[model samples]
Target: MENVAILVDGAFFIKRALHIFGKLTPDELASKLCSYSEKHLARDRKGERNKLYRIFFYDCPPLQNKVFHPYHQQQIDMAKSERSIWRLQFHDELRKKRKMALRLGRIDDINVTWRINYDKIKKLCSGRLKWHDLKEEDFSMDVKQKGVDMRIGIDITSLALKKQVTQIVLISGDSDFVPAAKFARREGIDFILDPMWAPIKEDLYEHIDGLRSTFPKPCNKKKLESSY
Candidate 1:
C-alpha cells in the first residue's frame, strides 16, 4: 500500500466548500475534511488501499485586533467577531482529530485594510453600480497570510528529502506550489493535485503525477478533468 500525506490549504478548502457544498458547522467542516481526505486512501486499480502518513493543514489565525470598517461606519472588535469565534472553534476541533497537524501562520495585521469585494468592484468597473450604492456587505477585510506558503514548501521538501511518504496530495488551487511539486516528483514521490473541481490551466499538467477532485464537480462544466 502506498503511504500518503495530505496537505490542505485551509483557506482555499473553506472558501470552495462554502461555495459548492453550502455552510457547515465547525465540527461538520472538520469531519467533512477528514472524510474527503480518506477517499484518497481508497483502493486503486491495483486494489491497494493507501496508508495515511499524516494530514498537514495550513492556515492563518483570524485577526484578533479591532479595526475600523469604513462601510459599516463603526469600529469592530475582531476578536469577538462571529468569524473569529468560528475559526477558533474550528481550530480546536481539528486539534482533537487523529493524524492531523495544523500549521498556523500569522495574518499581516500591519497592512490589513478594508477592500471592496471583487463582484462589487467589477460592477463598478462596468458602470453597473456607483460607489455610493455600495453597502457594508460589499466590503471585506484584505488580509495577506504570512509564512503559510513557506511552511507548505518546507513541509513538502522535508517529506520528499526524508522519504517519509510515497505520495503527497495537495489540496490547493494556487500554482505557487509548482516548484515544490517538481522537487517531490524528482524524489520519486507521486504528487497529486486536488483543486476541488476548480478549473486549472493547461500548463499546470506537467508538474504533477495526477489530478483528482474528491467532491462532486461544480455547476460550471468548464473545469479541467483528472489528468491521470
Candidate 2:
C-alpha cells in the first residue's frame, strides 16, 4: 500500500480556518485535518486507503510581546490576546495528536517596525493624512518567519528522496512552495495541493500532480479570503 504524508502550513491553516470556519478549537482543527486526509487526500485512484506516514505542521511561536500599534503607539500584548492563546493551545493539541509532527520556525520578533503602505505614504505626502486617521492596515509589520519555508522545502525533498511516502498532500495556498512541489513531482511523488477550497494560479496548477480540497467552499465565497 502507498503511504501518504500530509504537510500543513500551520500559520496559513490557522488564519484561514479562523476566518472561514469561525474559531475552531485545536481538537476541531486536528480532527478536521485527519478526516479530510483520510477521506480525500489519502485515497488512490482505485479508491483504496493509503497509509498515513505522518502529518507535519509547521509554524512559529507567537511573537513574545514588544510589538506595538503604530498609530496608537501602544505596546501590543500578544500574551493576552485570545488569538495568541488559542494558537498556543492549538500547538499543544498538535503535539498530542498521534503521528503529528510540529515543526516550529523561529520568530524574527526582535524588532518592531512599521513599514508604511504605499498608498498611505502617498496620502501622507499629499498632506491628506492625520495621526488620528490611521488604521491598522495602513502599514506593514516586519515580523518575519525565519526558516519556515526552508524547513518545509527540505522536508518535502527529504520525503521524496528517501521514498518515505508515495504521495504528499500539502495544505497551503502559498505559491512559495512551487519549487518544492516541482521537485517532489520530479521525484515521482504524487504531489497534491489543498488550498482549502481556495483558487490557485494556473502556473501552480501545472506543477502539482493534483489539486484537492477536503473542505467545502464557503457559500459566501467572495467574502472568504483567497489566501492567508
Candidate 3:
C-alpha cells in the first residue's frame, strides 16, 4: 500500500467548508475533515486505502489582537471575535488528532490595509461594472501569509528528497505550489492535488499527476434537506 501524506490548506478549507456544510464549527469541521481524508485522499491507485504517514495541515494562528478594517470602517477586534476564538479552537482540535501534523505558518498583521482592485475601481469610474460593484472581493484586506508558501515548499521538497511518503496529496487552490508539485513528481512521487472542487489555473494542469477532489460540490439548502 502506498503511504499518503495529506497536506491541507487550512484557510482554504475553512472558507469553503462553511459553504458546503452550513455553519460548521471548528470542532465539527475537524471530525468531518478526518472522515473525508480517510475516505478520499489516502487511497492508492488500486482503490485500496492505507492510513496516512501524516496528515499535514498548514495554517497560521488566528489573530488574537485587534486590527482595523479600513474599508469597512470598523475596528475588528480579534481578541473578542467569535471567528478568532473558533479558529484557535480549531487548531487545538487538529493538534489532538493522531498522525496529524499541524504545520503552522506566521500571519503578518503589521501593515494590514484595505486594498482596492485597480481594475474594479477603473470599471466603476467608467460605469462599466454593476454586478460586482461594491462587492467585498473588489476591496480586500491586504494582509500577508508571511511564511505559509515557503513552509509548504520546503516541506514538499524535504518529503520528496527524503522519500518520506510514496503518495503526496495537496489540498490547495494556490498555483504557487506548481514548482513543488513538479519537483515531487520528478522524484517519482505520486503527486495529486485536491482542490476540493475549486477551479484552478489552466497552467497548473501540467505539473500535477492527477486531480482528485474528496468533497463533492455541496448542494443547495433545499436539495440537502430533501436528501435527509
Best by lDDT: 1
* Model 3: colliding residue pairs: none
- For candidate 2, write residues 97-193 as lDDT tens digits: 8889999998887765678777778888899987667786576566688999999999999999999999999999999998998999999999988
- The worst-scoring run of ten residues by lDDT in candidate 2 lies at 219-228
Name the lDDT of candidate 3: 0.78
Residue 190 error for model 1, in Å?
0.3
Model 2 error, position 30 (Å) = 2.9
lDDT of 1: 0.88
Ranking by TM-score: 1, 2, 3
Model 3 residue 61 lDDT? 82
Which of the two candidates, 1 or 3, achieves a greater TM-score against the reference? 1
Model 3, 80-163: lDDT tens digits are 666667888888998888888888888787866676778877887889986444765466555577788888899899999999
Provide the lowest-lDDT 10-residue window in model 1: 219-228
Once model 2 is optimally superposed onto the true structure by TM-score, how far is the C-alpha of residue 163 displaced, in angstroms?
Answer: 0.6
Each prediction's RMSD over C-alphas, in Å, is: 4.7, 3.3, 5.2
Residue 100, model 1: lDDT of 99
